[model samples]
Target: MEPMIWRQAEQALAGLLAARFTKDIIRKAEERMRADVHGTLPRWISAWQRLPQTGSLDLEATRQTSAVVVSNAEPIDLEPLTRLLMEFHPWRKGPFEIFGTRIDTEWRSDWKWNRMAEKLEFRGKKILDVGCGNGYYGWKMLAEGADFVLGCDPFLLYVMQFEVFRKYAPQPHRHFVLPLGDTDLPDRMQCFDLCLSMGVLYHRSGPIDHLQKMHGTLKPGGQLLLETLVIESDQPAVLVPKGRYAKMRNVWFIPSVAMLEIWLERTGFEDIRILDVSTTTEEEQRRTPWMTFESLADFLDPQDPRKTVEGYPAPRRAMLLAVARK
Candidate 1:
């Protein structure tokens, strides 16, 4: 079938990867996607392939933040569409509405967008969003007049979500969510106009490497918007959580804003400016029907909300922008 994932990612990457291991990358990605089917993934893909596309779809990625609304679809049945969407459960970072059916996600990603859009200017910029969940922010970036947005996330479900958006969206070539992580992407030294690493830094054991790689991906004088979890700490100003923070076992390092700035400077990002910092609230991340897992509410200490159930500081995130000094 001409490698479905390649067809999905090719036009978006276009010239970037055409002569540079595109075939090998596709081969590996194909292997990964088709490997050991133990759960709902196979069924999800089958259903997605068989699902009907709506007629004369009207698409909007800007009118509503974290949403690529497909409206004016009298031809598509809302219930069937909703059922198909539910197959890809746990929509984390979007509030997409297909036809009239609303998929309110776990995170009110619009809040994150609002915080970012105020500082971001994407005109004629080819941008990269690492750890981009469902490519929600990429749609917003395009809405802000970006030339193109390439999103990278290893998770297949998010890639599927992007495909869902693509089926309804015209000119989806402008935005793509590739099924690749930080290690997977080839470093095209000094290529992107801007690079964003939001909500991803702390996930890496070697956070400095993540920052350096982000810097490597940016062209000279390119901008980087880095948003990640932070902690209010004392001397060290960085916390290595014992087990879990906000019920996420994957979190490794949560640095104070000062510590993060130092890390950025060490990683060779200049003119670093802290834009925003806010503690994650229940309203921001809670169990929605779309993402049924226990969220921030279930993670925080019941008697004292500021402390996590593990008794560590609650989740707080910071947004910082810098120019790559490379």
Candidate 2:
């Protein structure tokens, strides 16, 4: 073969090897996640779909009387999420443990789900956490005496992450990544007392599809816990350059609380209630935008009065929490 051709062939083989290695690593990570979760909650765990799911709560239904019911996906063994933190964040060494056994660390301090937890009564009731990132809220529900708590997300990486953390901070009856939708949920669906979804809708390609899917999962009288980012002013929602959701460009920023209320009604979620409305702090502004990697910073200092030139403006950092019943 010609030398040039041989060199090109070598380059192609190297690229293939790199891709294969990355894929294998991801696969191993997933297997590790499944193994940890199944190891901890073997009796309570079971996959609803063919895919491997993860979380700490038992998803089996237990005579739920709410409008929505929770169920488990298939069971598997996986590693603890805490171990990953230790491996990745060894620089900040400590006895690193879960902040609240009731809630995982990610959703606890900043998001303030504990405030909402005050109004919710999950004892002996079934709860479904849609888009249950790291299974934190589901852990909270289970800790609060929920009969069954299921945490569902479509992302494999998230399910894996949930499984990893679950071992160190085990909760009862929370299943993860069991892809629930209208058709699958309707079949053999159990009713639930309450359902929760947070920090999820914005990432969706079709938020309405997910909402409808959750509606099918609910029983005739179950409550839905909902939260998302919203636009406060009447002006159009802008897509920040290099924003995380900007890649998909499917994020719809509702300008008013009334708009969200109307959409819920249209989707057959009645008794719609706006639970809380709050603006982002300057620090939050910096961190969230930094997550997008959009700018250098939100401001020079967290307390800076000016929205940082390098960070997302405060107006673009609004969040909303609401609830309704089907």
Candidate 3:
């Protein structure tokens, strides 16, 4: 399969990369994608491309539920579309609607969007989303009136998920989902007007370095929106889970909101604001038809909802907004 992001590099980035700094960022992004394809990636790409080419794809995306509706189509072939989409299983982020097929993902995702949307203004901004699963929020960002959105995630399935939507959506050039992560980002490129890292901080073994990378990606005075799992506490504290938090083996540092503020200050981010802090609910994340797997419900302790099955504090997320220091 041809590289999924090549067309975006050629078409969408025409005038956007006139600046030398941004051009190099794009160049490194391309190199990373080329170097990373492996395992079931080729199969996933083929399945995505094989999806029926339908016309009259009126792409109406919304901030509510992160749903992208493809209406006014010429009799969408749902059976084959379902078959092809299922090839890339375990859909985590979106709750997208393609030709009336509601992909009820594992995470309602829109719940998080609703909490953060009021605090953020995406209009006319060049945005970068770290760990952007399936570009769901990227679409929401576009709907919020973003000029351009670039999402980077190491997950190949999520990249394929974006391709499935792009095949039918109009003005897809405005959004591009790259197969990369926070560590892979170009150092201090200072390209984007806004940089967002959601549900990613805990996964990083090196939280301080992750903060630095996020800080480096932003232009001076650019806004950085961070959402992460945090432990509730009075004093400054961080939970380095001995084994796993919520059955997720890779989770490392989950800090209190107070600790996070200090970390952001230390990392050279200014004007920090804590937007919202809410514990994730079962309604917000549960096993769905589209993502039929163990979910937040499975991760929680049966006796007490506030604790995980592993007995850690149940997932509580915090949305933080900060300005990149000049």
lDDT winner between candidates 1 and 2? 1
For candidate 3, what is the TM-score?
0.92
Compare the candidates by lDDT and give the number of the best one: 3
- Candidate 1 colliding pairs: none
Order the numbered candidates by TM-score, best leading: 3, 1, 2
50-70 per-residue lDDT for model 1 (tens digits): 667553224344544456676
TM-score of 2: 0.55
- Compose the digit string of candidate 2's lDDT tens values, residues 233-292: 454443332543322344544335556566566665887766666654433333221033
Segments of candidate 3 deviating more than 4 angstroms: 2-4, 14-37, 56-66
* Alpha-carbon lDDT of model 3: 0.83
Off by over 4 Å in 2: 1-84, 87-111, 168-190, 234-250, 253-255, 282-326
Task: Pick out the ten consecutive residues of candidate 1 with the lowest summed lDDT.
Answer: 55-64
RMSD of each: 2.3, 14.9, 2.3
Each model's C-alpha lDDT?
Answer: 0.80, 0.44, 0.83
For each candidate in turn, the TM-score is 0.92, 0.55, 0.92
TM-score of 1: 0.92
Which is the better candidate, 1 or 3, if ranked by lDDT?
Answer: 3
Task: Kindly state the number of residue pairs that clash in model 1.
Answer: 0
After best superposition, candidate 1 residue 226: deviation in angstroms? 0.7
Across 1-326, the per-residue lDDT of candidate 3 in tens digits comes to 55646756556765554456456656666665553546677678679668766743343445444576655446777888888888978888878887777888898888888888888889999999999989888888887789998888988778778878777666557888877788777677677899999999999999999999999888899999999999999778999999988999999999999999999999999899999999999999999878888999889999999999998899999999999999
